[model samples]
Target: MLWTITIACLLLAGLIFRQSFRKRNEEIEMAGDAGLAILEFGRAFPGEAIRAVISTANGRTVFLRLHDGKAGCMNAHGHHYSCHLIEPGMVHVTGAGPKRLNVKFSNAAFEGGMFEFRDEKEAAEVSLWLLGSFMPGLAAQNPRIVGQPG
Candidate 1:
């Protein structure tokens, strides 16, 4: 009886360890894929990428900065997320004109691991407009904008 119990416990421990490893792998995979997608889809960004922020109704600010700004956050399960980034504006001085640019965004809320794109097409349209303003040449050339079907 003692040996049987010991064997069963060992098997259970091994199973648990396997599950842990699997979960870790899944997380890494999701992150890698997400990074690549963002990099590819958002390559038009000049200088550096920034994060955006969004305030939930409950006052729980789900960190949206990572989608574009600094200190961006991604949903642990990759469900609903958003971020922002600030690019150099036309008028370059403190309050000279439209001094700073603040672009906000949110990713499509996916179910489980499946991502959602509420209006990627519309977002892409806007993305192109802004990118063109800040980075005309590159934005025009890159395939991230609508004119180029970004």
Candidate 2:
């Protein structure tokens, strides 16, 4: 009788393990698709209009340039994505290499790391986006204030 109960428990554990593996595989398959990333991001932020998308080489992360001059980032997390708006004074960025950037976010929930792009130009562009996030409204508020020596 004890042996029979042990076998049943083992079978149940095996079934649970298999189910978890299947679910993880499904999530992996959904990752790295640009359209899905964009769609998910849109769903998260309905008001933001995406002007451009810069995807990492592995497609795990996507950077967005919004029409209003703000920037955003979407990172795949298991079956879903964590989306965050690059707000002014919320992020710090530095070039780690010719094609990589070391990004640090003030938000504790957001994970920041070294992001590698296809080339130096792409890295520079992302850096600009982070830098621009700090002063997107300044130019529109006072055109003379921009590019003027203090």
Best by lDDT: 2
Q: How far out, in Å, is residue 62 in model 2?
A: 0.7
In model 1, where do residues sit more than 4 Å from their true spots?
34-150
TM-score of each: 0.33, 0.72
Q: How many clashing residue pairs are found in candidate 1? A: 20
Give the Cα-based TM-score of candidate 1 against the true structure: 0.33
Candidate 1 structure quality by residue, lDDT tens digits, 19-46: 9999878655654454443453255334
RMSD in order of candidates: 13.9, 6.3
